[model samples]
Target: MAIDDRVGQAGSGVRRDLRDALAVLAATPRLLVALDFDGTLAPVVDDPEKARATPEASRAVERLIALADTRVALVSGRALKDLEQVAPFGDEVLLVGSHGIELRLDEADDVLALDADERQQLGVLEQVLDQMAGTLDSVWIEPKPAGFAVHTRLASERHSRVAHLVAINELKAEAPDATVRLGKDVIEFSVRSTTKGEAVEHLRRYTHASAVFYAGDDVTDEDAFVALTADDLGLKSGVGPTAADHRVAGPAEVASVLSLLATLREAHAADAPDTN
Candidate 1:
């Protein structure tokens, strides 16, 4: 589909859901805007370390952060340290990494700990994944504190399928208790049970937000999308079946959505009655 057509479809939801979402956000006393990093704010890249937010997305987030009673956050499946490197927007933007298992707000960093048995199982799983990667061309393993990921983004389609199957079978045999999530061209396994849904809920409570706006572009992001309530907005940045109420073609359209939200929020703030 054409980019404009996709964006139009996103903006024109069932009976103006987007419009209603924006209106609620504008009048909300406290707002929490959380976005997925990869494929939401930034395009996916071969080198994961090379990913960065698009200029438009960066500017829109900055504008949102500047608005009164508005908080902006990046929630991702990446490790906290890796996310910190990719999204270096300082302390203003909250960071939820490791698929909500790791959180960094301001200087405080909270990471979930794995018990000895879980750690041992993860280690075995990692070793098996490494062995499996050696057999498949262009397949690599990403080590994480909770577990690890098998990445096949650069592999051929057939090879990717084979590698993923092999990895899943091995993970099932070795660490059946591990939580597995499939996204794009990657399969992530974690010993801890956490989801972007829990992360968004935590942020909502932490910020005491009256309304929330979350945007993402992956299967794992469906957790965050499902977390949204009537008072919140969920945006899907790419195509495929999703729980998001709205859809945008890609990062550019996501930027436009955020920009509009920031503009509306700023106007609302300006028009609010002053208690002072």
Candidate 2:
């Protein structure tokens, strides 16, 4: 079915694709599922802290975890503690926070802490962020393990652009050695090596994930998209980019995809003739 038809009908293109993907996931014993939190699992919000997973989406992922022989991971630019608070799967899902700078397999205490210089960069960033917040109205900053961000999603488009420019200049001046990056309504600065691509590579190696499915939305997620191989599934959750293997409209569509996957897993299990 076409994309429009899928929206109109219950189990169409999105549902069929999701069913196919889940069949592949269940057929393979070793499956790795990685997702970006904001704008992927949860709707993007002005107050990042207020962002929470939709009940339907959260339940879908939980069902996927329960049914499939898969290891699920939540990878985001947010700090470890912050990502945990926002993620739908919580500690049950492996956490790759701070742009994968901090990782936790099962619990927050299991988190891999940041190094010394990365820690110091946080201090340096705090000063720059404070200045940016002072200058821009309806703008704020979010501090992470190896970086800091200025968010202007709540501000007018003009102020958002201005804040982005100012934040870029200030962060560049403050941390010349650090890599500065931009995202939708946000600007970030972080240490050189802590990137989404590097995070994907590391997670793939650690998990020995023979098959992978990565879903995300945002500029930072591009790193992971590039890292994906032909056999892996790279999904872009929002508008823009024919680059991803699959394109989804928003978090609700993503949830729909996951829910269909859960249903498909059950279908496949029933179809198998053997008890094993």
Candidate 3:
């Protein structure tokens, strides 16, 4: 319940509160472990394409995937195609990309379709972002299926501020009703409305999970954190401002959390009676 709040730690370095929470979560009839990709599972990098999950994190997720009644997922702000290129585990982990606008449930999942009006709105959004980004150095635009994100991670302080300000104003003028979200050094605009919170709710209902574990690392992640019910656990990775009830240092600590959950879940599954 209390994630980042300091409490006594065991020899394992995990807080007593977290360990107790995990123990309870592991015993639930169904569990959903959903996470944000960037900065949560993979370390945030200047070049988003090169990002990958840490070795320990990969092993931890694999372990969870092997357990019965447990579903693991990576919910991210990146477009599904871009996310697929950098994120680990392929179909082994369920994916909610484009801030929940896209879902890859299985190999047979249908692609997202844009109607005529939505397609027109996206075209206008992309053009505004690309043109605004073209005017600045080290500022670039990333295209998504329903919208685009303006990345200023590589820009100088002045250029970054300018990029963000210009993008916000332009989107306001061009796509007045579009969904706009600001993240760490990134400003995103989408014609279709969605959020990580929506993604979490979707996953929870889809899996019929009695308990959920969610971790994230950015402001956009607040959406997901707030979506969590009391029965769910929210861990914030890295720091700044967050709605998450618990906090972990960064991707490494996140790996530890996952590994711990995997271990606890493994034991619980073993002790579960054979219903067959």
RMSD of 3: 3.7
TM-score quality measure for candidate 1: 0.92
Local distance difference test scores for all models: 0.86, 0.75, 0.86
**lDDT, candidate 3, 1-276, per-residue tens:** 232232223117777787888777778889999989889999998889899999988888898988889999899998888888887575778999999999987565778898998899998898888888888999988888888888889899999999988888888898897899999999888889989999999999988999999999999999999999888899999989888888989999999888888877777777789776
lDDT score, residue 181, model 1? 93
The positional error of residue 19 in candidate 2, measured at the CA in angstroms, is 5.0
Model 1 lDDT per residue over 134-186, tens place: 99999988988798988999999998999889888988898888888999999
Backbone clashes in model 3:
4
Which pairs, if any, clash in model 1?
A: none
Positional deviation of residue 206's Cα in model 1 after best superposition, in angstroms: 0.8
- What is the TM-score of candidate 2? 0.84
Evaluation by TM-score, superior candidate among 1 and 2: 1
**What lDDT is reached at residue 47 by model 1?**
96
Query: Looking at model 1, which ten-residue stretch has the lowest summed lDDT?
Result: 1-10
TM-score, every prediction: 0.92, 0.84, 0.94
